[model samples]
Target chain A: MASLLKKLGSFAAGATLLFAASAALAKPLTVGFAQTGAESAWRTANTNSMKSEAEKRGINLKFADGQGKQENQIRAVRTFVTQGVDAIVLAPIVETGWEPVLREAKRAKIPVVIMDRKVQTSDESLYACFIGSDFYKEGAMAAEWIAKNAGSRSKIVELQGTPGSAAANERRKAFADELAKNPALKIIDSQSGDFRRSGGKEVMEAFLKKHGKDIEIVYAHNDDMALGAIQAIEEAGLKPGKDILIVSIDAIKEGVQAVVDGKINAVVECNPLFGPKIYDTIAKIKAGEPVERSSYNVDIVIDSTNAAALIGQRQY
Target chain B: MSKSKSLSPVWWPLIGLAVLVAVNLALNPAFLNVTVLDGRLYGLPIDILNQGARGLVLALGMTLVIATGGVDLSVGSVMAAAGALAAVLLAEGHGLAVALTAGLGVGLLAGAANGLLVARFGIQPIVATLILMVVGRGAAQLMTNGEVVVIKNDAFAFVGNGTVFGFPFAPLLAIALFVAAQLFLRRTASGLFIEAVGDNETAARFAGLGAARVKGLVYVICGLCAGLAGLMAAANIRAADSYRMGENMELDAIFAVVVGGTALTGGRFLLLGSFIGALLLQTLTTTMYNLGVPPAVAPVPKAVLILVVCLLQSEHARRWAVSLVKGGKK
Candidate 1:
């Protein structure tokens, strides 16, 4: 009887110790983040959002800048896995060459949350969830606005993004697909601007010379290109918003201001603020709660009505 | 025979330009149409000149550098840094004069550095300029803090977008510079000196030519040209995008120099050929847009066209083609 009681007491002590150790491990909720380099305004804003949000939530964040290289990013992920953080966040620079490093993370039993750009892997189970903006939705939203504002038989010209880029291809595809529903509305001309202001201006100038006054609407894949088209339109002695309806995506600070000034008629937001959504998903993962495989931050369409109010609030 | 050969090479780019224009016209009847809008020219032709102005200016400097048997890979980066400095200055409420001078000064300094590396330190031109090519953009990014710095000054904008007597200022500036440079090269002994140094630097040095000084000066001139091009690019957009400004422009400038019949191995250079070459490239881009060619397949056609032009310019290729034709006839 005495030996049995001693055995029960030791088992109770071991159980208590295990529980205390787990509590200690779960308290800080450290997360490792591998970021794409601060190559642009949007990317910088995304980085700032991640940092500020982590501070607000009292979560420990380990940040690594990939400096626009996939090798550096893979090295960062390896470091994160070795560190044994509770979760890992990756803003992949490219889509492939991630399987091996990701497999290492999987072996370590760490959940990875992919942010802005996605990684391609046959094993979907490698990542816990993907948190990114829906580029297709942003394009569809812009096209929907065009369909509503543009009357029947409106001829449109599209300024595409960099060729073969996910954002460019998906945005162009979705816009075309959505606009296909309306038979009368047609894209008279489409060309890649390489997602640049100068390219946009040059291409728009050619489109104007080719199509002339027949072009009724201009849809640009991004704000920079739209801004360039605005210059081209003005140079042609035609009012941008008044003469040709302009629809653009990314709703950047300049894009929003252009909307308020009545240059761009519509801007579909591709929110770079992934902080709140990222943390919410992380919290769920920590609590053994079910989370969706992929979730996109909600984006809104900005026009004359809300552009004035929102222009001042744009961080990027 | 050498003079004839040299002269014939220059005509190839001009011929290429004519051919591209014809192709554009065939595809779009309005390809050559120019209309007066707000007293300024608005047409694909004008657009080509305006858009090609940056390349033209860069190619001018590149041609000189190439003539000296050196390449300025840093010109693109110099453009970025100079534009960033000017944009930041103008954004901070500085006058256009201050901004422009400072921008040009940055170019001169960057060129001097590259010249120092190549001439003073005896480093390879490719390796020396590659240092700036990598770091220059980073420095620009640092200045702009990774954001596109927008400028609102009309005077500054005028440098890029303004028109003089219905002609764009950028192209005019480019042409004026070209004419002046061409005159200076032709009228003085400096052109011969540059050619002598390029053909054989050791032999030129032995012959009492200031080879290093000539090399250093070309780099400075190239830097200045790139600086002007950078400012024009920034002014054109009314903003300074550090990341995107002057990206891959070195390759374009080199392409222009090569296409203009300037031998990459150095010694011989043609300014007019480069001018036409730059225009030819811009015409090709505009032609692609006018045709509404999908971006995915665009590069293939562009590559094929470039190959054809290059083949036509090559004596060996022309000879081979002639032989193949004769053999087929037999």
Candidate 2:
């Protein structure tokens, strides 16, 4: 009995030491990534990048797909707070109605990192930082490239993305802003393609039949729409990549492939793959270093000059 | 069927389509222009035909299901599943035949499942089909892992974007399917059994007809038709987007079926009516687009149009209109 007691004492001391040792070194960061939803190819890439990036950095990621609903995102945030995660990452589906849920996370002292879309709240403390491509910049980048390449007086028809979507609205705004600088540039027609390949194709076909060769440039909000417009252009017996100067955003795989194939003239990168960049920010924040309030991922203006080389590295 | 009655159901939709076309012609004379370029027909009319082909194909199968006192709400989801399956199969280096078979097979099985639920399990057709309408889209998303699966195959591409004798093959295929469906019903006892079962199930069963088997068979055919439509849509765009490919297509198919004068209560079916109805809907949409109406409000006019068509199809409304016209003449 005495020997057993001695052994128990030593084991208790060892247990204490082990606990002390672990307490001395902070526990690995556990980030709860509350993804908006995998509604599109971009969303899929965003989710995939977060997951794989989390695995690479040894961070425990609690993922919840909100299925394109704000209510689902709010519920997932509540669950993450209850789980006592180190931090929370949110790719908001919409721009409003997040104050209450965000307050709950803030009350728990969990720093939130917003990605993809913005939260409408004015409070800067609601999130640790915003990490994504600047929509306004993405728009300007495409417009500048188009205006420079196609000359100022080119006839442009815009295939806008889904109406009321941030990407669509902001991109359209930036394009308008840039077009003002070039007085000769005229937008002959504009319509919403809903950011789908099929929509782009249908709308472009209508534009072709209506306007014919009057349309010199097709400004699609995203690559899918641009790709769809290419089909329409080809069916109309016109070369897409050259005959119609195609400028779109989001360097997705097929879009880049099209650029290489000489279908799309230029694509502005939105960089949906946020894994490595996100992890780097989290590491800095954890190390007691100040991070930027809004970190914009670098946007690239991809055209024939660099499209062929970058097609292999394209993530979304 | 008698020659006069054969085209009876077709005339209303045909007239409606012609009227819309005529209005478009007056507004924009370019709407009637058709030209053959490089062995393919190209024009606004042909574009409308291609656009309507997806819904027309679904309407073809939906007509049969509605004929048997059942509605398959799962047609749209089935289209997504078939498109995703075919896309994934082709992406995995499988032959076009394998992909087509597998895609159609998924559709048939999905339809069969709906049939079983309603026929064998005694569930309401709407509720039974609703289960698939919700779940099958998820199944499609899973098949593609929530990404648009883009593929390239010459033969498969030909099915969607190809032409037969210089007309778009998709519209032709829908017409062929409608004709085949019409012949199958008119030439065989299946049509009588279906009409009998739909009109009164217990009475038909008492009359020694297999009502459950008939309902199950129609649902299966409905699934197969949706599968073909899904394939055509995916092929048309050369990409299978499970999320958006067949999104809300069920409503379009149902609209075509209803506008074609197929009563929701079920008894008789009309194949050509659905075809013309599909064409009518497509023509209206093209007109709206050509007129530069915002797409958000595009559905508003369609809603009004369908309401008018429904009201016009009612016996009381038809009798009232006829009486008023005759009284004026007197």
Candidate 3:
């Protein structure tokens, strides 16, 4: 009877321990986020979005800042793998050189989700999904807006971003392609502003001197360059929004503000807030559901009509 | 021969500038056209001067530094740091005077640190300045939290955008500083001391020329010039971008100094040559823009043009070319 009573006690204790272990397992999901450093205002906003979203969802997050280095990001990934994170989110700084580390994550079955920039790999299985803004579409949207709004014979001067960068290449190609549909809207001159305000100002000053009032439209890859061009235009004794219709991408706070001020005609939004969408995608992946290999966040066009109301919503 | 001798030091850069200007004019007949609007000069020529102002100031300091057989790789970074400090100060509601002084002070302090490292500790100038080059940008980024600090003060902006007698203030300030420095250096024993130390530090020291002190002093002056350039760049944009402010400007400054006929090996220096060199480079950039050269292909032509000018600047290359032409004619 005594031996039987002892066995019953042991079974009860073992059953309680199993129940506690199951409860712990169902507590909350833990995720590891590998960010590509706070390099710019856009990047800072992206990071904040992710962090705040994680907090709102009650996920245990392990954050790692790569500090603009690929090696550091790789190390962070390895650490996440070792920690046995439920999911891993990576914002790669470059496209290539991510396959090996990603292969390791795949082996761990951590479900890596790429954000903002892209990763070039033959095996798409290495990453669960990629969520980023479509640079080409953004450029096309800007061009489409111009074709509809500006006169058919409008002469456009394009201020490109840094040479050979992904954003610059795609934006330039798409804008040119879209503008090709409307041959009358000719790009009179295009130059690389190196995606810098100073570059934009200098190039705009030259363009103003060379082309003068002949340029009716200034299409810049990014808003910083647009702002710089606005300064150049103002300095040249011409009203920016009145004399030249300006269209640009990346509706950063300053860019949106410029639209609100009526200095810039329109700005295409390249939304940096990826937190909510990323979490939704992760949830689908967690539920053992099929997910798209690559998904683009739909961008919006912000003009004077919506700019003022949207300005307060801009976090970056 | 007399004409060639008179133009020997700065003639090549001048020719390059003239050629580029001629090319721009060829591309567009209106390239040289200047008009006044709102009491300010508006033209490609004025644009070149205004845009080249930062590089001109940097070259001014770099010329002196190179004359002493040293190069300050930190000028660009110092520009970023000083501009960041000034922008941050103004953003926080500080007076323009305080902001300007603080910005200039950062340059002086950074220069003094570099001087101490090189002169006092006997570190190589390149390595010593390299330390600041690496740290200065980081410091600037830290101060601005890696975000651009937008400045909204018109008084400060005037330094970069405002014109005096229809000329951009930045270029005018640069020219005025160049003139004053030229007079001061050429009219005093200070220039002799710098040359002596640069030529032979041991000989200058043995002759009681205070070689170390001269070496230290040049860095300070360079720092001050870079600081002012930083302020001008920030004011022009009305924002301090710690990341891109003065990026690669040290290289431009060095190129300007070298193109201006200053030997990297030390001793001989040309202040006016650097000024023209800076203008020539700016003209090349403007020419590219005026011609609308595709961004990817622009660098190739720019490189070729710089190579030709550099080759022409070489006495040996010119003599060899002349001899080759003579032989071919025969």
Candidate 4:
């Protein structure tokens, strides 16, 4: 009986040793996701996607909502670094003032992924991959559509997004670059709509009063502004799509629906639903697989031609 | 001539507003035309009118509250709560009259809670109202499950979107409220009592002015203004997005009141000045947009303009300017 007990004890010790070895080999990946506030439906959807995808992949996602404050976001990043997260994802509030914190992340040897918004850091090597719709390209696409639909002689009024945001900057740059291709396409007046419905409306109203019938096209950086501009246009006793062509980025459901209603002329899709792709990218990096530095492409445009068909599938 | 020499505080703000308008016109000649009025008056510009109307109403109530040596930061949040409640009830197919009545009732209840906390418990007005300011938005968000409730009732819509004699109903409603408040303050003993309590609370208390009761009444009045503002906002957009409803409105309202020549330190009230202040802010924003300035950059000019106005109004600034002029002459 003593000899039998000795044999069982040795067997138990061998099993424990093997378990320890496997445990040492398999390390859990800790991912920190700093999100912008759930200010809009698109932001909420983006957050949910990231969370659900993280859960499915068995990655620990440490989440923080910035509440539209840059300071809060910077603090969250510092907290993530102190907690020794394996990877980090940032959806920045603005384009500047991130180089120092990003350098800290680099020193900590954690891979960083820029989720939706891009930052204006001089160093490009600090992040692993940027996963977002190309805002500049999206803006140019909207402008191109307007140029094609409205012809070269149209007098355009631009409705810009949030002042210092990458989306706003890139969209404006790209739109201007495209419009520069057509000299006759004069941008009569431009103003910051602040990426809000009311901001868009107020600016549009002022634009209408200043330009009157000479105003041909209304180009907004986002759908909300476009929608707001449409209200202003209609309120002035002018047909929105017929009299003043409205084109905007962010093919959110409302924008697409507006296209269907013939209230807006065109909508350039800026897909906010980027969840599964982000999770897979993080997993690939963890497994020592080669991942592209910039992976996603902007969505296709939706206009009156395809508005009815695509409105049903539009999400945010 | 002697009475005219004793300049009313209202004239100061009015003069400042006129000078600012002149500056804007000088900077951009197209700013003064009525043709640009149509587009600017629709969404964002119109929303400003909406905000101004609401701010005027709240400031009118706040004027009373401040007169009683009290402050109410929760007016914006109360507006949100009222909007949320109204939106939810309306979404549930409740009668327009019923929903509006319930909204006002809720506002009164919220005000009463604030009043009771401050008056009955002897809590500081700022502290008492702060509690609601922080939690009221959360309550509003929770009420609508954080969803934007799109209202469809035309009767409810009329209050927000409809026009009266070619004038937007909201601005008109605000004007009506301002006139009523002006009448109340200028022609009533209750207004005098409020100002008396604010000027010297202990003295007013000693004089048997029922200072606590007067203080409580202002909070209720402030809540009612917020309720009305919420109704107008919900109607104009045909939706209630609690997330952004009346966001940072308290700051704007306080700024309007302060810029209107109502002392932040608390003493006198100016109904017309507050109204004009609201209009000034909206016009400034509209003008900035019209002048081809980027939206983000608008805040910079606005900040500078406000600083200039405030500095001009400061006694130290006024003295310095006068001395500089005298020195220049010498």
Q: Top model by DockQ, which number?
A: 1
lDDT string for model 4 (B302-326, tens) is: 8877777666556667678777888
Name the candidate, 2 or 3, with the larger lDDT value.
3
Greater lDDT among 1 and 2 belongs to 1
For all candidates in order, state the fraction of native interface contacts they contain: 0.96, 0.43, 0.89, 0.47
Q: DockQ of all candidates, in order? A: 0.72, 0.50, 0.71, 0.32
- Quote the lDDT for B203 in model 4: 92
CAPRI-style class, candidate 1: medium
**Per-residue error (Å), model 2, residue A151:** 3.3
lDDT of each residue in B1-330, candidate 2, tens digit only: 123334466677777888788888888889888888778888888888887888888998998899988999999999999988999999999999998998899889998999999999999999999999989899999999888898788789777888989988988888888788789899998888898988999999999998999999999999998898889888888999988888888988888988898888999878888888888888887787677776557778878777777766666776777678889999
Model 2, A1-316: lDDT tens digits are 9999999999999999999997787676899998887788888888899998898877889999898789999999999999999889999988889888898989999888899788889777887889977989999998899878986448999999988788898999999999999877878878888898888988898888888888899999999999889988999899997778999999898898888998899999998888888888888887778999888888899899998899887776
The alpha-carbon deviation from the true structure for residue B316 of candidate 4, after best TM-score superposition, in angstroms, is 5.1
- Report each candidate's C-alpha RMSD, comma-separated, in the order given: 5.9, 3.5, 4.4, 4.9
Ranked by lDDT, the better of candidates 3 and 4 is 3
Rank candidates by lDDT, best first. 3, 1, 2, 4
- Which residue pairs come into collision in candidate 3? none
Please identify which of the two predictions, 2 or 4, would achieve the higher TM-score against the true structure.
2
When candidate 1 is compared with the true two-chain complex, its DockQ is: 0.72
Flag regions of model 3 displaced more than 4 Å.
Answer: A1-27, B1-7
Candidate 3, residues A172-211, lDDT tens digits: the string is: 9999999899988888899999988888888999889888
How far out, in Å, is residue A70 in model 2? 3.0
